[model samples]
Target: MTSPSTATLHPIGRSTPGTEWWRTAVIYQIYPRSFADSNGDGLGDLPGITAHLDDLAALGVDALWLSPFYPSPQKDAGYDVADYCDVDPLFGTLADFDVLQAEAHARGIRVIVDLVPNHSSDRHAWFQRALAAEPGSAERARYLFRDGKGDGGQLPPNNWESVFGGPAWTRTTNADGTLGQWYLHLFDTSQPDFDWANPEVQEEFRRILRFWLDRGVDGFRVDVAHGLVKTDGLPDHLPAVDGDSMGGDSDDVPYWGQDGVHEIYRDWNRVLAEYAGDRALCAEAWLPTVDRTALWVRPDEMHQAFNFPYLQTEWDAAHLREVISESLRAFPAVGAPATWVLSNHDVVRHTSRLALTAENPQGHGIGPDSPGQPIPEVGLARARAATAVMLSLPGSAYLFQGEELGLPEVIDLPGDARQDPTWFRTDGERYGRDGCRVPIPWQADAPAYGFSPSGATWLPQPAEWATLARDVQEADEDSTLWLYRTLLATRRAYALGSGDLEWLEGFGTDVLALRNGPVTVIANTGDAPVALPAALESATLLIASTPFAGTAVPADTTVWLLAG
Candidate 1:
């Protein structure tokens, strides 16, 4: 295991001028907990990720975006880092991370880690020292603190609600039974928000960025990147639907986009750009509209912000076309290229999201054993349609772990077995994110579905998920994995990533036809078979979801045709 400090790190793709490489790159996101487990503890770790580097590289992704693996108390599944500099023992040692970085770089895959600067675990030494009233401590000032006064005298700086539900602030008790004044969290109460206004805090974070970059990290998928800044005056939030205040007096107090966030991101981007030197800064901004979201990627800010509209878009062909067109129009021409994500650790799997019918729509919404439903029989076809649209769009594509295998969302979890705090706090109305965060199934017949050889996994594996594991599907050329591989390989060969999208006019509402030079990708979203355009009548079929032995096309299929 070689440390990045000692390893001979190589730059990716000849360092093209500016950040153009991202325009055509395929980034594969790995949710560490579910990717693989090497310790048999039923938990995926850094070493497990290292072991599976070949799988990702073989998939032909240009880069790998790993979710947080920093040292933590397992609050928010390592998103709350107690220490940013070291690896959590459960995941593996720092040496293991260095080895993983080396291996990934060796395979021509750039590694981008998640950077959570908005907050740190409440248990972090800095926060702990602040609680002790350490004299003139720089750490104490790193967090927002104010004397309990004004308003109700017992009110927290302002009436802000936690994203996980409930009030954002928690009362602190001193050893002498005195009501000590302290400000806590914005997301999970366990994850304390940082005071970005402090100069020391800004400098420390900049150093943190440089630390990873100096260690040969390619870049970062900044977690909640827009949250570093807060409105100066702790203002009360307007009443939300539930009449609860959200996130103190801040510009971002509103549910989605806020004003002050841009400056914070711009500052971080400038610092990161100086350190990154062509590396990218992809953001996870859940802003309201595509135009508003594009504000974060104005060349001086984020290189790419995840376009979530595709995740929420309806399955109709026209609606999907509108989303892609709208995104391309919204993004700034000179900024980083646009990116798309169908599923991630935080959302329901696409299979579950798209599988719903009028009869089974409620089941698809959220519940236990949801993955085992016959929905895939209907959903897999939709999945192919979505893939064609997603890959053919003029932007980078991101695939969540197990997505290529057409894995469905997991819905069943006993009360005590739930891992997501959002689920517990929301009283099961949200069904928790645990369903999407389940361990990955690797073998159909292997115990624990090849995610582990030990007993039950930390989170229950989908009962029949083993059938869709990589090993099983890899052997079947017609499997979902094969389709994904073929699609990815073909798309790569044709420069689909960099090609300009030209939507073919006069196509039926169910058909989504886009041409990239002479190659045309035609997707059918309807149940009835549609005739191929006369212009494409003489075209050769490169790939099709259904058999293309003859000229007649099958229903619910996508055909990639090359102009003769």
Candidate 2:
């Protein structure tokens, strides 16, 4: 095959070139609760993270994106912040966090904490003070409050639905047995949404950002960044379906590109620009279209927003190519780089999403449920292809923990074991995320699979995961972990961090190819061997997901070719 040509891929933001290191970096997300445990409390902590810096360094990632470690009531796995600046006692002390940060930086791995600005725990001091109506209190403006009519009228200030499967507003009772003011929570009722429209709220959050940055944090992964702004009038939302009301109390809808969100991000970016060269901001944007997603990265806004289309879209070569192409093309116009993620804390793993078949694996045309067998060989192949495509693409990539090792989805959780709030809704029609959020399997033979010292872990480790633990795969060159390490190291070495992508024409539906300089990665997703292009015949193989049968590429294999 012809050696893939290197083309100039423009940066997305107005920051000077090389100033924003995150643009071309690979970020590894660590869900602290499931990462590792130090005190054997069945929970992972900062010190545990400190112990794993070497593993992350070995993975060759440029930065680490920790999910949430702040003080919380454990309602949403630490997403409900009780205190922004302090570390949760369940996780560890601030001193331990400092040590973790220091160790990570020493290993050249930048740390980015998840900052949940959309809401706070109802028990938060600000919310508590607002409840008592303290005079001249700044906390009163921290959240939205509205008067209620005692004549059986219980309307909220606005109509917004909580993301956790219910109405967003919750009414509080007054001391006189009448309905008092109501509070808005876009997610859980206990987690009240913040009033970002207030100038004081803006300044306080900005100060919070600075608080961490001054203490040596490299950046922040903003939570629900777009949800910061609400509609000005707080009008009842247009009903989508009959009986589909916001919390069964009102018809308020809460999301979808609310007004004033861009300006908020722009202002936040300006504050971040002061620390520009080394730090960055990654937004969690969930928009309907690629153009809308690009809007968040416009020059003075977020450096990069999560491109969720790929995570939620169907699996296919053609569809994947179209999404990648659109995202890449749209980014440069608005001065924001494209970011790719296959899995995160909120979604199922790719292995579960794209079920692979041993017979007909690899390629864009493969069906989502092709892999029905319990053995994950085909799923492993698909995961490898995903990594190859993600890293080879032009922008930044995010790798969820254990994903590098081809971890499959946890589908069978006992009813009582389920932790996700959504599972309890409607007789458990949804399986809840407790399965995917189980403890990481560190050692196959160790108790609790090396997730904790206790005999039992917080969640049962998939019995099938015993054969695929870190210790088991670390020694096997054909293991998924090995493939990930090699791919990550290669990308870092070749400056493949960012580049222009050229999709080869005439490739079969199951095959996808990307050219980034002198390297071309051809992934075969079918059951039969694919003929290598004449130009690639002279190329040397760097890695392959499956054994090569003669010169032609075997099915379910990723062939990395470099011109000789």
Off by over 4 Å in 1: 1-9, 12-14, 134-138, 147-152, 182-184, 238-256, 275-277, 357-365, 369-374, 546-556
Q: What is the C-alpha RMSD of each candidate to the true structure, in Å?
A: 4.0, 7.0
Question: Any residue pairs clashing in model 1, and if so which?
Answer: 235-249, 368-412
Number of the top-ranking candidate, with TM-score as the measure: 1
Instruction: Give Cα distance to truth, residue 347, candidate 2, Å.
Output: 0.2
Off by over 4 Å in 2: 1-19, 134-139, 147-151, 155-159, 238-254, 356-375, 425-427, 526-528
lDDT of 1 by residue, 1-564 (tens): 332233444544446654466777888999888888888898898988887877776677888898988889987999889999888888898899888888888777888889998889988998888887742466578887665656534767677667666676776666677676657577787888888778787778878888887778878898876566666676776434432122221234533345666777777777766653367788777654677678888877778888866666767889888878888888746455678888888766777777664222211235653434437666777776687678776778888998888888775667678877666666754455777788888888887888876745889886778788889998998887887888788888888877788988777888888897667888778877778867788998877875555354556678888988
lDDT per model vs. reference: 0.74, 0.74
Over the stretch 388-416, how does candidate 2's per-residue lDDT look in tens digits? 77887777889999998788867665678
